[model samples]
Target: MSFHYETPLVDQSELAQARAVMGAGMARILGYFREDGARSIRAIEEAFTQGNAAAMVIPAHTLKGESLQFGARRLGGIAESIEQTARRCVEQRLAPSEVGGEVAMLRGCFNETLALLESAAPPSGTPRPPMPGLAGTRPVTFGTAPRTFGRRTG
Candidate 1:
């Protein structure tokens, strides 16, 4: 079955912020996935399979944070669930199957997110003007307040 994502996973306004932060370094940002995303995904999956809940949680959380910063809404949404599940597992000693399910869901989410990002045209030669509320902003910090409308801040 297809994974169902919560609404507002990606906000168009956030895309503007991401483009502004990249500031002609868009290629470099996308390159991270081309180079190391696969490895990171594998590591996350491996951690989940091994029942290393903490490891799974850590990577998922990192991915979620990064994805949101980059305005990768789809990826961020999936990773958020994985992060939550991992957290729950760590806190309450959940079953391995539960973690496994979350990991599987995460894999699908990654694939879809990657596809969506790839399909989008790269940032234009002349960077578009930053969106309102995002102009003159600094790069987003991990686990900080969400910067877009329709998304939970903090």
Candidate 2:
């Protein structure tokens, strides 16, 4: 069965609201995201490689919170899914193998989110370009291939 991923690249209203509170600090926040986001992604992969399903929760949760803070709702949602799946794997006594599908889904979402952010590059030193209404929507295409840990298979 196919799953329809409907979350957008970012939520403009949420970003605008955050911008109001953060003011000029928004630039630094985006910069932190740019640096730490990739690190968190890599951390998730590393956790998978170690066959530690529980370890996935930390990075995924961290990414989820950070993504939400930066108004990247879709990315945050995907991260949240990863976190929940990891917890479920533990709670239901499922093997790490059982998490393969969710991991693949997260990878696809992460890749999509990264591509959108990269393409929307603002001028150097400028904060991330706030994606407006319906501006970041792209056709969702979930991959079926099973991605193995320790390798960038998606």
Candidate 3:
């Protein structure tokens, strides 16, 4: 397999696979990736500040997996490097500062991934299908109270 360095910004094949599997839920899935990626970045920062090597591994690993899933090859590689470095620190074979540098690299890659994904995403006017369990429900308009199930509130 080619490394992230050689891979494109987004792997159409993986995205096609995701669309095939997720169907109408694909929109939400894409949203989740963006939200989660940002959250993972924060988590990594917190773990690094606290000197929690093991904790660092969790977010980096998560970011790596998510990036790969989204076809963000370079970002995935950077995250993977960070994850490995954090693992090494946890094993006492390396210093946390070593992982810190990798984190900086990851930040740059992450920003690129976000920009690519934003451009790839559907336009704002596109309508999203309701999620499962909320099917057939009407959306509450602005200035209107939310509807309750099986009862009405004054």
1-154 per-residue lDDT for model 1 (tens digits): 4354554545667766676666656666667864555666787888876877777777777787877876777677667777787788788887445656556766666666666655553655756557568768897768655568785655
Best TM-score among the predictions, by candidate number: 1
Cα-based lDDT for every prediction: 0.68, 0.70, 0.73
Cα displacement (Å) at residue 52, model 1:
1.8
Cα deviation at 113, candidate 1, in Å, is: 1.8
In candidate 3, what are the lDDT values of residues 11-130, reduced to their tens digit? 777755544445555567668887888899988888888788788888889998988876777788778887887888889855577666666666666877777765665554465544
For candidate 2, the C-alpha RMSD (Å) to the true structure equals 17.3
Off by over 4 Å in 3: 1-7, 122-154
The better candidate by lDDT, 1 or 2, is 2
Better of 1 and 2 by TM-score: 1
Using lDDT, give the best candidate's number. 3
Clashes within 3 Å, all models in order: 1, 0, 0
